[model samples]
Target: MPRARPPPPPPRRMEAPPLPGFSEEQFRAACRELDQPAPAAGGPWQLLVESMGVRIYRLYDEQSGLYEYKIFGGLADCPPKLCADVYMDLDFRKQWDQYVKELHEKIYDGEKVIYWEVKYPFPLSNRDYVYIRECREMDVDGRKIWVVLAQSVSVPQCPEKPGIVRVKNYKQSLAIESDGKTGSKVYMYYFDNPGGMIPSWLVNWAAKSGVPTFLKDMQKACCNYSKNT
Candidate 1:
């Protein structure tokens, strides 16, 4: 009989502290900024900030996309012990800063990241008002996940409606990987509409309507296709 394969090796743990290079003050500052509220009033369009403003502090490992530390939310309000493991590691901060810089640069060209649709369910009749927004991909966990950082602006409501409304939306997607020779996996996380903004009405309508159906259909299409091996 063939010898049994050796047991898979145990998972190795990192010994570093969180965000080594950055000081507690720095982390606190970043968190504070993230928690700050957006401007109340704005120009022609009402502006509200999106939740994508997370100050992610992660520690990368040998594993393709493993994360050692992930701190989300403002420092003051965030769980004090969230990333206690490596919250003080020096090398981690160096890498974190580099990643943040790259992320900022990616935001400028977000139109190329993820595609968005102006109208929900289906495009408009003339399709003239349709807009496609792109999502920026960031390395999260051990792989590239689409991340969108958006700021909101107040906009006029319906001509009949009296007051403006505040809405929050996010849009991001990830292309699951398949064997390089075979191509990619079909599963995708369509985060939000263009610019990552969704009106409250859209959210309610989507849950009641058939957006979930669209998502499932997309997934099936990807899963059913066979590579041209």
Candidate 2:
């Protein structure tokens, strides 16, 4: 597990404007994009992982350090609601979200600011992200869906700590649609530029390896969630 820094003086969640003024439209736009599914085939995306009932894709270039990933899969014995609950349980997240070393949050002004640091393997500087998380559910053509959105944010109350690189452009979302049975379909998106320099090989493997592992870990946690609770 990582470390959790002390809570700061109460500050609004995403309202403190990390860059400039962030509007509600931008937030809704992100949600819409994540909810839209990627085309069945043909695109810049390269299939990386196709095991454990999950498929992960990546789009990147040798010259560009920025990386983007689209991960989709079905949990053999997990429901969408259980999966969403586990993902939202910030406390349990630190346990199953292997890369996370520290997780904390400050709530104010009707917004939630999540502060977390992720450990990168040796020689790579540990990366951190401060994202605003929002969850919404709606009925689409009579079927219900749940979406959770998170994007990197900067707040005066939460300053960059020493010894870690801040992921200033991290944006991610998790979308799940229940099938009215015991199963659900999930779509996850991630894009970010880890500050400073990192090897392209490291980036490739993180998408191919890191993401698949995280998905399986999430499913396992869901299986025994009741026991733990």
Candidate 3:
């Protein structure tokens, strides 16, 4: 009798979602808009919040250009793609290796959208708040206008390590396209103080200290150089 063939080796797994900010639909849409085919559809495409050890509810909104993702309640490691200066869909393990390396050297360069996870211990009797700032250039009538920006506190409802400590007194602002008459809109995401459990400290202190401010200045300097040269 002839030997039976093996069962096709169970199809290969798909890639994980881009990042927390990118949902299935939004990612799909963005890929489609760029004339790129969507990543394969399968069981492994979803992200496993190692801390929570569960899959998150991912939602998408093409109209406002946003993707809403919900997780448990703790600090989740930064998604490799989101934390990278460049964006590419690659193996999580591979991307994570680079993430840790860049983080250690404090030379991680982020692309268009910067997603950072800042942590500080709770019960801050003597400490400063963590802030997130975006370096952006304003354009008016197709011409570069002014370089204006600001920094604000951001509170992330991390999933995984819950009940111990959470981000409180969160104040985050996003630059939104406002009606031409109203100039531009700056939206805010704020919350009350958080529970004091973890010490008011940081996980990557050297990496973030004054980095955002430095980046903002760097952008302005580049624009000035371009104009002169």
Error of 2 at 76 (Å): 1.6
| lDDT digits (tens) for residues 1-229 of candidate 2 | 8999888988765555434334555445444543544535787887777767777877774555565788877666788778888888888888777788999887644567888889999988899888888777755556566777788877777788888998888778777876557877778888888878888798777877777788888889898787777
lDDT of 1 by residue, 1-229 (tens): 9999999999997533221122334323323322232322342222221232322222334433322222222222212122221122223323322211111111222221211112233332110111123223333344432222222222222121222221233322222222223332222222222223445565444333333343333333333222211
* Ranked by TM-score, top first: 2, 3, 1
Q: Which scores higher on lDDT, 1 or 3?
A: 3
Which candidate tops lDDT? Answer: 2
* Cα lDDT for residue 107, candidate 3: 15
For candidate 3, write residues 1-229 as lDDT tens digits: 9999878887786643332232334222222221211223453223322222212322344553333332212112322112221112122323332222111111122213222333333433222233333333334445322221223233332232433333323333222222233232212122223434323234123122322332333223333332433
- Judged by TM-score, which candidate is best? 2
How does each model score on lDDT?
0.27, 0.75, 0.28
Worst-scoring 10-residue span by lDDT in model 3: 99-108
Model 2's TM-score against the true structure: 0.80
lDDT of 3: 0.28
Q: Candidate 3, after superposition: displacement of residue 115 in Å?
A: 7.1
